[model samples]
Each structure stands twice: as structure tokens, then as C-alpha cells.
Target: MAETTAETTDVASQYSAQVASDLEQNLKEQERLSAEIEALQAQLAALQHNHSVLTNIQQALGTSAAAAVSAAESVTKVPAPRKKTATKAAASRRTKSQKPATATAKRAGKKTAKASQTQSAAQSAAPKLVELVRAHLSAQSEPRSAAEIAAALEQEQPERGIKTTVVRSTLEALVAKNQAQRTKQGSSVFYTSTDTAEPAADGDQSEQPSA
Candidate 1:
């Protein structure tokens, strides 16, 4: 009887120990799962807050873009200012104001044309400087200095305003044309006319009748 009672006590203690160990393991698992749930809840709360902020920014941007488009449309839809109508009195006044300037310009142009014509006629009437220079050189029997020629011409025509520089330039032009000869003697320059004509060609000489 005592032996049967000791076996029953040992089996009861073993069952109780196993039940206590199972309870401890269940508490640890529950703690770990609770911690993971808290971390996941915190991450989910952060993501929701970020999503709310992004939604607000998107709404603000859309409102701003819509407002800008409305403002642009309003500006483009505004009417332009109307031009002033030309009344008969205003037209007459403008014509009167412009007529004097137009008439003045026309008179000025006419006066300029007349003056130019008068100057041209006077120049045409006068002998050319080159002809005068050649005539003076040809009239001289010997080579004449530019100063003497200029002085004689000035004396002959006091109103002509003959300049020595102009005479010298004319002499040089004649020399270039081979119609005058230039000679230098001891720093003094003189010019003489070339009255000799070019020699006739051989064909011309052959065509000429013999005396």
C-alpha cells in the first residue's frame, strides 16, 4: 500500500513541473510578439504621417497651378485699348501744321537746285584750268617757271583767283599726259609745251601721194 502511494506522488510532481515550463515558454513568446507589434505600429504610424504630408503638398501645388492658369487666362482675355477717331477738325489742324514744313522743304530744295545750276553755268562759261595752263606754256618761247606763269595769269585776270599751287598741279598733270616737258635746273622747276605731233605710222606714209 505505501509503495503504490509513493508512485502516484512522483507522477503528479513530474506533470506539475512540465506544466510550469510550458507556461514560462508561452510568456516569453508573447513578450517577443508584443515588441514586434509595437515596432510595426510605430513604422506604420510614421508612414501614415508622411503620406498625409505628401497629400497636403500635392493639394497646395495643384491649387497654385490652377490659380496661375486662371490668372494667365484673365490677362489674355482683357480687351485692348481702342484707337482714337480722326475728326474733321483734327484732320484740318494736322494738315495745317504739316503744310508749312512741307512747303519749307520744297522751297529749300528749289533754292538749292537753282544755286547748283547757277554755279554749274558759271563753271561752264569759264575756260578749264588745264586749257589755260597749256595756252600759257605754248605762248612762251622758252621754259617758264610756275610762279611766273601764275603771276602773269593773275595779273591778266585779277578776278579769277589763280593760285600758284593750282598752276603747279596743272603743270604736273600736263607732264603726265606727255603734252608738256618738265625740266629741273639747280632746284628750280620749269615747264614747256610739247607742240610736236606723234610721227605718222608707216602705213599712213605709204598711203600718202608722192610730190
Candidate 2:
């Protein structure tokens, strides 16, 4: 009886030791799983904080970019008002310092009136010269120089200062008007009237060619 009791006590002690070892292994496994869960949570928190930081940086950069764009547009747009103001000021100064536009117009009108009077006198003078040229041409059979015409007219009417230059210019004008034609010999121009009623070629007068 005593030997059986001792063997039963030894088996009981061995069974208790096996159960304690199994319990210790289970505690170690639980510790490893807990550590893995804690590491995963820490990594997740770090990822979330990085995402928030990136979002904030992007928002700040967008705000600054918008401000920069607005500033650049203002730099170009601001000059238009200043230019308009300067133009208005320049025009006002010119208005104060310059003469009235009508005064300048009046001076121009005076010059135009004097020019009109001169032109009218010249038109009137042309007819008198034409009459004198025609009368001389009608009386002659041979062509005569303008100087000869002027000299004859001066003898005929000596009271006037009938210039040779005036008669020459008049003869030239008659030639331009086709009322007379000119023939040239050496250095002289001679005038011949183109009319049909002059003294006949074989009548009392004879044509004298240039000597």
C-alpha cells in the first residue's frame, strides 16, 4: 500500500509541471501578438499624420500661388488709369497755354483773301495784254519779236510804261492759248497770229523772214 501511494504522488507532480510549461508558452504567444498590433497602430497613425501634413502644404501653396497670380495681373492692369490721367492733364495744359483754334483760322483766311485779290488782278491784266498782242499781230504780215511789238506800242502810246518783258510774257501766253504760233531763228522767238483775216500774203504787206 505504501509503495503505490508514493508512485501516485510522483505522477501528480509531473502532470502539474507539464501544465505550467504549456501556460508559459501561451503567455509568450499573446505578448508577441500584442506587440504586433501596437506596431501596426503606430504605423497607421504615422501614415495619417503624413497625409494631413501634405494636404495642409498643398493648401498653403495654392493660396500663395493665387496671390502671386493676382499680383502679376495687377501690375499690368494698374498702368491704364495712370496713362489716362496723364493724357487728360496734358490736354488741359495745352488748352490753357495755346491760342484759340479760331484765331489761327482767321489768320489763314486773311492770307487766302490776299491771294484771291492778287489772282483776280492777274486775270484782269491778262485780257489787256491779249488785246494789245492781237492788234499788233492783225496789222503785220511778217512775224515780229515781242521786243519789237513792245517798242512799236510804246511809240504808239508813249504815255504808258509798256515793258518789253510784259509783252514777251504775253506773247508766250498767247502761244500757249493757241491764239498765236511762234517761229524760232537763231536765239529769237517771233510771234505770228493764227487768224484768217489778216492782210493777204500777196497784198500790200510782204513776209520778211528773219535777217
Give TM-scores for every candidate, taking all chains together and pairing residue i with residue i. 0.38, 0.34
lDDT of 1 by residue, 49-100 (tens): 6577557655655655565556445544545435444355455555565555
Q: How far is 208's C-alpha from truth in model 1 (Å)? A: 26
Error of 1 at 190 (Å): 1.2
Each candidate's lDDT (Cα)?
0.71, 0.68
Q: How many residue pairs clash in each candidate at the backbone level?
A: 0, 0
**Residue-wise lDDT of candidate 2 within 29-59, one digit each (tens)?**
8755654565456457757865775576556
Top candidate when judged by lDDT against the true structure? 1
* RMSD values, in order shown: 52.0, 58.1
Candidate 2: residue 205 lDDT (0-100) = 54
| Model 2, position 83: C-alpha lDDT score | 80
Clashes of 1: 0
C-alpha-based local distance difference test score of model 1: 0.71
Error of 2 at 107 (Å): 40
